[model samples]
Target: MNRKQPIFYLCSDALGDTAEMVVKATMQQFAVDEVNIKRYHYIQTEEEIYALILDAQENGGIVAYTLVEPNLREVMKRSAIEHDVQAIDIIGPLMQAYIDTFNDSPKEMPGLQYELDAKYYNRIEAIDFAVKYDDGKNIGGLLAADIVLVGVSRTSKTPLSIYLAHKGIKVANLPLIPGIAPPSEIFTLQNTLIVGLTMDPNHLLKVRTERLKVIGLPNTTSYTEYEPVKSELNYGNMIMKQLMCPVINVSNKSIEEAAVEILGLMNKK
Candidate 1:
């Protein structure tokens, strides 16, 4: 299409996650910066398709769409034909394949992947709570969390907390920085809710080095060195022993796996 920089047009009736995902995955097969994206959401009228088609033709762009509404999808097809524009129906091909093979049809409703129930809202609330209390922020309201995680840097605390939040468990993570006292709630919270997270020193060094690189910071500091990381791990273990709470080792485990262990401990107490 566009000789200078190809344009990728994504159209959808709801949020364009599917079409965007298709575009992104396809782009990964080539170069990362080869194309520029133009997203069009909630295509409700034929006039919108006509206007978008005109722009695609002018830019020599390809339109990839996931319009589940039958009438709107037809309008998009007709407009692309009238404008001599290249169009890709991202969902239609897959849907047709399912229909042909299984002799089944979809209800063609938008946003069927989303839930709006009490559990769903609770997850949203937990995610908010996790974000609010991440890294010991907003710990003045310690009773709000279902679980409190303490860990040195690069122990997968934040990610594990988020995974638990998605399962409707409110989680708070406190950083175990040397010379910095964590929230006093760590001492007062019941052993059930207060747990320590640790990781192998070598893995912690690698993780912290990569983290520093990502933020454009130097790794010359003691944060990523083996000895300092080992010292931090030892300190965390001592605190865990003193508090007599569960200690979860997150080395070589996924966020989901770590959450499962944390949840099991929470259930026990």
Candidate 2:
């Protein structure tokens, strides 16, 4: 068996959860099979902090520490020395890079910049909400989405959503169910850039067939039959047409490629 590479995350109290989500998502994107991650809370005592470091060192993997408090910086430095593994302190490098790149020309913000921050934050929250719940009823959550995807089941919506999120673009993906009426607002969201994803019928059937078997569902040929798959694609296109959405055939594309196409459309819009 290939040895699992451990990644220790010693994060400040404020940055842990976000960091964990980002790192785990990145690992999945890289298709890493063996990874172990651990998070540490902000520490007060030297002994307690040192014990955490000791445990990470014994785990014999890379350590990534995010320290916001200057007081704990020395302890972290010492731990890195003792661990003899690849260590990265997140903020230090990021700040250094920012200073090196943008130190010369500083731009002043407008008086309303602070107010606009709340607007942008709300937009991001709405995008996340829509990505999680893409049903037509929750189209309100996708109001802030720059790109919205509509497709049949198992058409790579979720992975594409994550991919777009990593690029700082809010993506919302909704599935099309044939014979079932879609939510109302999806037909009226003219401000949103919508993309419909379609796949080859034979390929779609094969994938759904295997998926159903894996989940111990009845291997009904409904999803895999040629006419049913064709109807699903047609229904998805009809939904897009009613919404004035652009359609993309993603059957031959990777998730990253699909995300890139979606982003390009957003930029064009």
Candidate 3:
């Protein structure tokens, strides 16, 4: 473990995704690669809170927690104070602010944000739309798309499309195969935001080779070769140029990171 890396301890009485989201988004403010995230979910007992605080003391790390029950929340606060560790109550302060502002009380419910609301159902519909149109399969209904992503193989088109879909964006991803022209309607659609995703040829080759290996196929195909990957990238770039869409590189970036840029580009257009 790198000592320069900060150990972030996340605790919650429910699944710790919200706490983790807080930590990860805060960590992005800094330009660092080494962050050790330790998640302690379903933490209901005072004993569990104490034990985690002890671990945080031992590591000299910070704690980020979301505890709804007052007793359990106090236990975490006291334990962190006793252990002399920096503890961040991810939900408490905001919950208090909200309660005071609205003159209401905390419901003390754990994981209430995970309820299947209208937004969740919208994401489900978008996911289904992306799956139905993946790999340029259903080009006829692409006129209904909110965003169209075009890229050669392994440029993260599918994952990016799905991630955007989860945010209620109707996304369609088309694979850029050499010698095949893109859908004619894509050029005609004026309202849809068309994006061209690209990746480093070497990285694409490695990704394709690993994918082939996972599917029990040999890596000897042109799909996994450096020269062929480079040619594909060039051809894909030519097509993107013909479409006059914004090009984004996905190499060495996470889905969220690329989505941020994609959304930014979409907003500009």
> Which candidate leads in lDDT?
3
Q: Which ten residues in a row have the lowest lDDT in candidate 2?
A: 105-114
- Any runs in candidate 2 off by more than 4 Å, and if so which? 1-9, 13-32, 82-85, 103-133, 137-148, 156-189, 238-244, 252-257
> Per-residue alpha-carbon lDDT of model 2 for 103-185, expressed as tens digits?
85323221222354756676566557555665544665556566777888988877777676655566777778987877776
Better of 2 and 3 by lDDT: 3
Candidate 3, pairs of clashing residues: none
Error of 2 at 82 (Å): 4.3
Measured with C-alpha atoms, the lDDT of residue 249 in candidate 2 is 82
Q: Which one wins on TM-score?
A: 3
Query: What is candidate 3's local distance difference test score?
Result: 0.89
- Total colliding residue pairs, candidate 3: 0
Deviation from native of the Cα of residue 48 in model 3, angstroms: 7.2
Per-residue CA lDDT of model 3 for 29-108, tens digit only, reads: 98877678999998889999889999998888899999999999899888888889889999899989999899998889
lDDT of each: 0.83, 0.69, 0.89
Which scores greater on TM-score, model 1 or model 2? Answer: 2
TM-score per model over all chains = 0.66, 0.66, 0.75
The per-prediction tally of clashing pairs is: 0, 0, 0
Looking at model 1, the pairs that clash are none
